[model samples]
Target chain A: MIHSDLIRRLPASMKLAAALAVVLLVTAACGGGSSSGGGDTAGAAGLEGKTVNFVGYGKDNPWGAYFNGVFVPKLESQGVKVVDLTTMDPGTAVTNFNQAISNKPDLIVAALLDTSSTVVPIKKAKQAGIPVLVFDGRPDPSVDADVMQVLSDSEALGTAAAQNLVEGLKAQGRNSGNLIAITGTKSGFAAQDRMKGFDAELAKTPEYKVVDIQDGNWDPTLSGKIATQLFAKYGCSGIQGAYGMADYQALPIVAAAKQAGCPVGGKTGLVVTGSNCFKVGIDAIKAGTLYGTATEDPGTIAEQTADYVIRYFNQQNPPAKELVKEERVTAENVAQFAEQCSKA
Target chain B: MNVMSAPPRSDAPIRRPGRSRSRAELVIDAVLLLAVLAAIVLALTTHRFATVANAKAILTSASLVGIAALGLTLITIGGSAVSLAISPSVAAVGMIFLSAQSFGLVPALALAVLCGILITGVQGAIVGYAAANPVVLTIAASFAITGIATGVSGGSTVSPTGGGYDRLNATPGGVALSVYVLIGLALIVQWTLRRTGFGRSLYLIGENRRAARAAGLPVGRTTAVAWLAAGALFAVTAAFTAAFNTSANVNLGGTLTFDAIAAVLAGGTPIAGGRGSALRTLAGAVLIAAASDILLLRGSSTGVQILVKGVIVLVVVVLVHLRTEGSRA
Candidate 1:
C-alpha cells in the first residue's frame, strides 16, 4: 500500500517508471541475480531484434494458461522471436532445458519444478555463454549462481492476506476465532512458503486460533469439498475465518461458507482471504464475499524480467533485485486491482 | 444366480463366466473383507467418518474411480493388458467436454464419447491387428493423448460455469449423481459381460487367442469393439470426473487408471485372464474410497495415502499367489 501510495503521489511519468521497477523486482527474486534498477537504459532499446527461449512448465494446467496464453505472448509482442518450450513434470523440464541449450538462444527464461534434475542442463547453458532468467521457484546455489532467480514474495503475500483476515476479525470486535487454512498441494514449495508466512504472522496474535489446516491441492473443487467437510464438522457458527492459498482455492470456500449458513466478507461473513488474485477472487471482493488477495502479476513479472535483461545487455550493467509490488486487495481498493486481475 | 445363468449360443470354445475354484480366491476375499472391517471400525470409532456427509463423500469418491475401472474391466476381460492410457484418454475427454460446453453438454458428451471410442479402438487395432504388445502400445498412446490434451487446453483448467450442467455434480436424494451413474454403468457392464455374444467372444479370445482364431472368430474386430465399449464407458466417466472437479484437469486420469486396474483385479478378475465381474470392481472402489477416506480423516498425507493403497494391492496379489501355491502343495 505504501508502495502504491508513493506511486499515487509521484508524477505520472515517474509513476510509470516506478511500476516498471516493480517488474524489475520480479527478475531479481528468482534469477535476474541482481536487484538494482534505475540503471542506464541507453542501449536497452537494442533488444528488439533478439530472440528469447522460454522453457516453461506448461503441462495443461491453469498456471500453464497464464504462462502460455498470457505471459509468453506478452514477451513475443515486444518484437522478439520467442521459442516456447513448455512441458510438464517428470522429465519434461529436463527435455526443455536440453532443447534450449541446443538452440543456444540470446536469452533463456524458465519456470522450473525440480532443481535437482535441472542442475546439469542449466550448467551446460551457462557454459554455452547464455544468460538464464528463472521465475516461479528458486534455484539452489548448487544449481546455478549466475542466473536470475526472481520469484513472487509468497511469504509477503501470505502475511498480507493474514493481516487482512485479522483486520476483519478485529472489525467484528474479536481477536481470536476458529480459522482454517485451505492449503495448496502438500508438497508444493509455493503453498508451503505461503502457509509458513501466514503462520508466522498469526502466531503473533494469539486470539485468532487456526483450528484446522486442510490441503486443497490448489483445486477449487477440492477446496470446496474441504470447506464443506469443515463446515459439517464445526457447523456454521463455529468457524470464523479461512485463509486460502490461492483465489482459485478460496473462491469456492466462499460459496461453501454461505451454504454452511455463514455470511462472507464485511464484519459479518467468515473473513476469507486468498493469495494470487484471480478474477473470481476480485469479483468476490467487489461483491463483499471475500476479504483479500495478492496480485501475482505474471504478465508484469514476465515483461519486466525480459525488459530488465535487455536494459542490462544494452548498458552492460545488471540491475539489482527488484520487488514486484503485490498489494493485498480488499474491497476498499479492489477496484484499482480489477483490471490487472482480468488479464490472465 | 446370473453368474451361473449363461450358456454359449455360438458354440463358444471358452465359457464367458466359468471359475476354477482356488484357495487364492478365498484369501483375496478375506483380505477385502478385512479392509471393509477396518473401514467399519474407523466409521464406528470416529464421529466424522460415520457422519452422513462422510458417507456421501466416500460413495462419490469411489464412483469416479469405479466408472473408469469398469472400462478397464472390459479391456482386461477382453485380454488386453491394462491400458495405462485409459487415464490420459479420459482426461482428454474431460478437456473436450469442457471445450464443447457452449454447444450443449449432452451433445458434446456424445461427441466426446464417440471420439474416445475411436481413439481407444485404434489402440485395440494396434494390439489386435498389428499384434503390438497392449501394455507398451497403451502406455505410448497415453503419453501421446495427454501431450495433445495439454496442447489443446494450453495448460488451462476449463472449469464448468453457470447452472447449465449443475445437475451433473448434484447429489440427489442424499446420493451424489455420480453414484447413480456408477451403479447404472456397472450394471450395464455386468450385463454386457454376461448376456452378449460379443461378451463370450472376449472370454474365448482372452482364454486362448490361437484357439479363438482357429475357431474363425474375428479377433481384431472383437478387440476393437471391446476397446470401443471401454472407451464409451471412459468417456462418460471423464464427464463426471470433470464435473466432480468443476474443471478439466490434465492430471485427473493419471491416478484413477491404476486404481481402476487394482479395483477390477481385486474385485475378482484374474490377472492371467479368464473371469471378471463389475460388482467386484465396485466393491473394490468402495473399499479404496472408504480406506482412503478414513485415513484422510486421520490427517494422512497424499504420499501416505498412496502408500496405503499400494500396500493393499500388494497384499491382495501376494495373498492370491500364496493361496494358489499352497493349493498346488
Candidate 2:
C-alpha cells in the first residue's frame, strides 16, 4: 500500500528528475571538502594574512603527499594562511575548483586530475578573475587563459633518457634489433607526452625498431609480469633496449628479466633506462646495470609551485607557465645526486 | 580423518550441523581434484608452468593472499560474513613495518603484526561486547585503519632504509619462505579448530548464538579471541608482503579482499557457516593460484580472468547452498 501510494504521488518522469536532482546536489556537497587547517603565519605584505588555497587530488598518492608536506610548509614560511583542499576523483576536482572560486583566495593552485572533467570549473575560476596555478596536467586551451601551469618538461626528460639508451645500445655494437618500452597508465599525460619524445628519439636510429610498447600501469609487479612475457616472446638475443617510464617500474622489469636469464646493462647485453631517478635506480646505474635515468625532483616541483603562487601574491603580472628542470643522471654523474638519493 | 565415511549412528549428539559430512566432503574432493587436473594440464602444455621459478612466483603471490584469507576464514566460520577491514589493515601494517625499520627489520616486522592484532581485536571486542553486527563493525574498522595509514605516511609509498630487507625476500632452495609460513599457519589454525575448547565454542556460537549463550558457554570471549588470532595472522601476511615488495603503498592490498573471499568460498566453505576447515583453505589457495596461472598462460586478459573467477565462485556458492537445502529436506 505504501509503495502504491508513493507511486501515485508522482509521475515516473518527475520521480526520476527529483532523484537525479538530489543525487547531483549531494555529489556537489560531498565532492569538495577542506582536508586540513594549516594554521596562519604572521607578517605584513609578506604573505602574512594572505590565503592560498591548494586544490589537490587524492591524498593517497606521491604528488598529494609531496604537495602537502613540502609545498604547504614552503608557503607558510613566508607567512601565509594555507587551506589545503583535496578531492577524491576528477569530478570532485571540478567541484572543489568551483568551491575554491567561491572562496576567492588570493591565489589558487591545483594538480589537474583530468583533461575533460576539470577544465570547465577551472575556466569558471579564471572567468571570476581568480589566478589559478596548475601542475602535472594541461587542460583545454580556451580555458587556459588565466591559468598558470608549473610542471616538469616531459619531452626533454624523455628525449634525454632515450638518447642515453640508444647510445648504450650502440656501445654494445648492436645495429638492428627491437626495443621495447614500458609506460605508465596509458591514459596519463606522462605516458602519452613522454612516448612522443621517446619514439621520436628512437626513430632517429633506423637500425633499432620500436617493436612493442606495453602499459605497465606504473606498478612494479605488472611491469615485471609484462617483462617476463616479452622476454619469452622475443627471446634474450632478439631484444636490444628497454625503457621504463619510472624508476619503480624499471626495477621490477630488470628483476624479472634477470630471473628469466635475459641479462641487461652494457656489460651483459641489453640497454635499460628508467625515469624519475630513484635512489635504487641510481645504485643500479652505478652498478652498471641501468644505462641511465631522468630526475624530476618532487620537492623541486613543489618549490616552483609555491614560488609561482607567492610571486602572484606579490603583485606584478606573473608568467602563465613555469616548468622545472629535469636532469638525466647516469653512471658518469650518479655521484652528484647521492646526497638526495633517499629523499624518494 | 574420514569424517565423511565414518559409521553413521542415528542418535549421534555431536554431528556437524546442516549437510552430512560425507556430502560436503564429496563436493570439496571434486573441486580439489579439478584444480589438480587443471594444473597437470598446464604443466603438460605451458612451457614454464612446471619450472621452479614460476612455481615460486605463484606460491609467493598465493601465500600472501592465503595468510590474509586464513584470518578472515575464522570470522566466516564463526558466523560473521567476512572482515572488510583486512586489506586496508594489511597495507597500514606494511607501512608500519617500513617506518619501524629504524629498530631493525625483525623488531619492526613484529611491531607491525602487533598493530594488526590490536586493530582487529578492538573490532572483535566491539562485536562481542556490544553485540554489534560484525560486518558493519569490520567495515568501520577498515575505514579507520586506512585513515590512520594515510595520515601517517601522507598516503605515499615507503620503503625501509636498511639493506637487510633483501634477506627477507630471499627464497632458500628455490622455494619461498612465504609458502612455508602459509603451511605452518594453516596447520596451526587446523589444530586450534579441532583441539581446543574455544574452537568448539566458536562452532556452537556460529551454529546458534542463543543456544550457545543458554548452554553457559563464553561466546563473547571466544569470538574475541578468534578474531584476535585472525588479526595476528593478517599482520603476518602484511609483514611478508612488505618483505616481498620491499615497498608499501596505500593500495598495496589491491584486489586482495575480493581474492580472499573468493578463495574461501571456492575452497568449499559454506556462507551459512558452522562447518568448515582450515585444511580446505589450503586446497582453495592452490586452486586459485593454479586457475590464475593457467589463465595467464593462455593469454587471458584481466576481464577474462575476472570472468572465470566470478563463475567459479558462483558455481561453488550455488553448490553449497543447494547441498545445504538438500540435507535439510
Candidate 3:
C-alpha cells in the first residue's frame, strides 16, 4: 500500500522513467544470461541490426514451428531482424522465396518442402546478393547458391531405423524374415533419401527381405490402412518387421497390426521402427508397442540451424554442409530421449 | 385466339410431383452391384483378399471417409454443392477435441462437435441467408479455419492425455467401433432424409429452388439445417479419427474433402442435388475402400491406386450424367 501511494505521488514523467530503467535492466540481464547460455553468440558482431528473410513452411508445420519458435527467436535475440515469409503450401513457399529474394535481405534462411522446385529461386536469391542458409531439405548438389545447408541426415535416420528394426527382430529370435516399409510421399526428397538409406542398410542383412514399400504420404490414416492391408496380405506369421517413416505413421501401423492380430514390439510378434523422434514414438517405446524410432527431431535441428546462422554471421566459416547428428531410441534408451522427443 | 376459353372439367384428383426411380438411379444401382460382384470375384480368386481380417480393414479404413461423406451428402442434397471447408473443419474439430480432452471425454467430444457445427454453420448461414456462393464462401472459410487452427496449434500435433476415447478405436468381434459408428450414422441419416419434413424440404429446394420458393418452402432454413447436420457428422469423423490415431494435428483430415466429394459423386448423387440416399453413399464409400485395398494388396503404387480411383469416379460421373440427361430428354 505504501509503495503504491509513493508511486501515485510521483509525477507521470518520473513513472515513465522508472519503467524505462526497469526495462533496460531486464534487457541487460537477459542479454548477459543468454550470452553465457546455449545461445553463446547472442549480440555477436555483424548479427546485430542485420536483416534476415526466413522462407519456409508455415508455423503450423512441426518443423516450421521449430524454425519459428526456436530458430527465429534465437536469431532475433542476437538483434537480427527476421522477416517471416513462411507458408503451408509448397506453391506458396516458392512464391515466398521469390518474394524474399526480391526483398534482398542481408541473409535468407529457407527450408523448402519441395526440393525439386527450389533450385531456381535459390539461384535467384544468390543473384540478388542474398546469402542463403538452407535447412531441413537438400537441394541439388549442383546448386551452390547456399552458403551452408543444415540437414537432419534423412538417410541416417532411415539407416538407424533399419538397424533398430533388425536389432528388434534379432531380439525376437528371428534371423531372416519379410519386412515392409511405409514411407512418406514418394516424391519427397526426405522420403526418397530415407528409403535409399534404409534399403542400403538392409542389404547388409539380405536374409531379411523387404516384401513391400508403400507410400503412406506421412498420413496416419493412410499408413494405418496400408499396414492393415499389408498384414492381411502377408498374414500374421509372414512378416516379421516393418518401418514407418514417422512416429505418427508408426503408431497407426502398430494399431493396425494389432487389429490384424499381428501385435508388434516386445520379444515376440512383428518388430516395428519409425523415424522423426515424436512423443508418440517415445510413448510407444515405453509401452513396448513400438520397437524404436530414429531422431529426426525438429527441435534439435532448429537449434543447430540457429547456431549455424550465428556462426555464418560471425564469419566463423561454417562448413558448406552440416548434418545434424541423429540417434536411435529404443526401449533401452527411450527414457533418456523422451523429454527431448516430447518437446518436439 | 381463345386462350381464356374454359373447357368442361372432370373431377379427378390432381397428383403432386413426387420422386420416382429414374434412369440415373438405375445406373447407380447397376454400378454398385457390379462393384460388389467384382469384389466377390476378387475375394474368391485371391486368398488374402477374402480373409475376415481384410474385410475389417476395408471397413475400418472406410469409416472416417464414409462419415465425412455422409455430411457432404447432406450439403450436396441441400443444393449448396460441396463445402471445400470440410477437411479444415475436420482438422479443426480434431484439434479442438484433443485440446479439450483435459476436460474429460464426453465434454471434449461435445465441445469439438459444437465447434465443428459453429464453423460450418456460420458458413452455411452466409451461403443461405446472404445468398453467397457456397464454393467461394467455403474456400474462404477453409483458409480462415486453417489459419486459426495453425495459429492456435503452432503447427504442433495435439496428443490426447486421457483414456476412454480409445474405445472408439477398439475392434470388437473383429469389427472396428468406427465401422459400427459409420453404419449407425448412415442408418440415422438415411431415415432422416426419407421420413422427415426437413429432409423433404431439402429435396424440394435442391430439386427446384425457384419452385420451392414459389411454394413458400423454407429454403434457407433447410440449407442451414443440412449444413449444421453435416458439421455434426464431420465432428464425429474428427473425433473417431483422433481417437483412432491417438493424436490430432492441423493435418488431421488430409485429402478428406476431396475423398468425401468423390464418394458423394460416386454414390450416383447428382451434383445438381435433390436426388440421393445415404445408403448409396455408404455403398460408394465401401466400394472405393475395397478397390483401394485390393490395389494395395496387389502391390500397386499410390499413383496407380489414385489413377484407378479417378477412373472409377469419372466413369460413374459420366454414366450418371448421361443417364440423367437421357431421362430428361
Candidate 4:
C-alpha cells in the first residue's frame, strides 16, 4: 500500500520539482544574483562602472524619469553608473536600503519623503558603514554621521521667490494684497520650510496678509481642484499672490487660474512662485506664465552623489556633510540657466 | 441562482471519473486560459516583459497575492467575506517581527503568521457573532488593522536590510517556498473538505446554514472554524508576501482583499459560497497576474489597468455564473 501511494505521488512531486527548477534556472540565467559587483571604477575614477542606487518615492513621476534619463547620464559622463531604485515607496524604502546595504554598494543616495519616518533606516544604513547621500529632502540629526545632506535652501528659495512675487505684484500695481499659501504636503521638510520662509517674508511686507493656507499634498489634480474652491471661497479679486511648493503641484492650480480668467504673469497678473525648477516650471517662467522658482539642478545632485559614493569607496572622507547652494531662478536670469535647467 | 435549492436529480451525471467534463466547463476554462495566454503572449512581444527578470517580478507579485488569495479562498468557501486589510495585516505582522527579531527571517515570519491568525480570528469572531454584512465588517476591519499597522510601525517602513534584502530578493528560490506553502495549504484544505466530517459540515453550513443545523450539523462552530482556517491561511500568505518583498509597509496587504475576492469569483467559486477549490483559485490568481503584466507592458496607464482588471473580473464572474446555470440545465 505504501509503495503504491508513493508511486502515485511521483508525478506530482516531479512536476513540482521541475517547476522549481525552471524558476531557479531563470533566476540564475538572468543574473538575478545578489549584487556582488563591488564599487569599481574600471575606466573613470568618479563613477563610470559604479551602480549608484537612487531610492526615492515615485519612479513613475516625470521628475523621477528626468532623474533616470537626463540626470543619471550627466553622472555617467562624470564616471558614475547610476542604478535608479526610486520605487522604494513608504513601504519598501527600508528593505531597499537594506538591499543596498547587503550589496555593500559604494554609496546610497536617497530621498527621505517623510524625514521622520526615514531617520531610523538612514541611521541603520550609517551603522552598517554605508555612506548616505540625501537630496531634495532633509535628514534628521540622529542620522547625521551616516549622511551627507544636499538640499536647496528652502528659506532662501522661499524668500527669493517671495521677493520675485512681490516685485511682480508691485509691477502689476497691486503692491501687496491678500496672499494664499498652497503647499503639497503640510508636514514634510520642504513643505514646512518653504511655508515658514514664505510666511516670514510676506509678514515683513505688511500689505500682504496671508489669506488662506491649505495643503494640496503636492498633487496637480488635487491642487487644481482645491484652487477652484479657494478661488470661489477666498475671492481671487484680492488674491494677488500665490506660492506653491513644487511646479508639478502648482501646474494645475495655474491652469485653474487661467480657466477662471484671472490675470497671470505679464504686468497685471497673479504672481506665483514654485520650486523643483522642473522644465515645465522653467517653460512657464520663460513664457511669463509665472514668477520665478528656486532651482536645485537635479543633474548636479546625481553627479555629486556618485562622486561622494566613490569617495566613500576610496575611504576618503566623503565630501562635506551637507552640500547646499542657494541658486534662485527668476525670469530675468532664467534664459541664461535654461540650457542646464531643461530636463527632457 | 438557486443551485442550493435545486433538488438532486437522478438524471444529472456525477463528477466522478469516466464522466466526460461538460461543454460549459470546457468553455469556461478555455476562456479563462485564453485570457491568461493572451496576456503572456502580449507580454512576451514587449521586450521589457519578455525578460526572465520581469517574468520573475510578475511571479513574485503573483505569489504574494496568491498566498493571500488562498486565505480568501478558504473564507470564500466558508461563506465569509473580507476586505483588503489582509495586505496591511501582513505588513504589520512582518514589520512587528522584523522590528523585534533583528532581521531574523524565520522568527519574523512566524510572528507575522501568528498576528495574521489572531487578527483574522478576532475579525471572524466579530463577523460570526454579529453576523454583520461582510462587506461593512471587512471595511471596518481594514481600517482598524490599517490604523494599528500605522501605530505599530509609526507610519514607517519596516524592511529587511543588510543580508535580509538578499533573502527577500531571492526570487526563484523564495518563490518556490511560497508556492510550496500555498500547495501545502491547498492540500490541507482539500483534505479537510474531503475526508473530515467538519469540512462537509462547513460546506453544508455555507450552502444552507439553517438546513445544516436542522440536519444535526454543528453549523456555527464549523463556520467559525472555516473562518479561523481562512485566517491562518491569510496570515501565512501575508508572511510569504513580506518575505518575497523583503519588506512590509503599512499598506502591504492593501491590494490583496479585492484581488483575492476577484480571484475566488473567477475560479468558479460562487460569491454566495459552497463551491470551488484552492487549485482553481490559484489559476485565477495566475490569470489575473498575467493580465496585469500584459497591460502594463503595453504601456497601459494605471487607470487603464484598473479598468481592465475590473472588466476581466466581472466577465469571469458572469461566465462562471453562466457555466453553473448551463451545468444545471
**Top of the candidates by lDDT:** 3
RMSD of each: 13.6, 7.1, 12.4, 22.8
Worst 10 residues of 3 chain B by lDDT: B3-12
Q: Per-residue error at A192 for model 1, in Å?
A: 2.1
Superposed Cα deviation of residue A303, candidate 1 (Å): 1.8
In order, candidate lDDTs are 0.72, 0.72, 0.82, 0.63
Which residue pairs come into collision in candidate 3? A60-B155
Instruction: Give residue B10's error in model 1 in angstroms.
Output: 20
In order of TM-score, best first, we have 3, 1, 2, 4
Per-residue accuracy of model 2 over A175-253 as CA lDDT, tens digit each: 6768888888778787788888887887898788877777777766556556655665566776788888887777666
Off by over 4 Å in 3: A1-45, A144-147, B1-47
Candidate 1 reaches a DockQ of 0.24
Relative to the unseen true structure, what is the C-alpha lDDT of residue A156 in candidate 3, on a scale of 0 to 100?
Answer: 93
Per-residue accuracy of model 2 over B1-329 as CA lDDT, tens digit each: 32223222121124355635667656765875896687687656876566555665566557778888888778877777688888888888877877778788788877987988898888888777678888888778777877888887777678766655555555556566778889999999978877777667676677777876787777788788888988898888777766555567676666677778887888777765666778777777766776666566566654566688787888777766766554454
lDDT, candidate 3, residue B276?
A: 82
Better of 1 and 4 by TM-score: 1
lDDT of 3 at B98: 76
Fnat of the models, one by one?
A: 0.28, 0.17, 0.49, 0.00
lDDT for A49 (candidate 4): 60
lDDT, model 4: 0.63
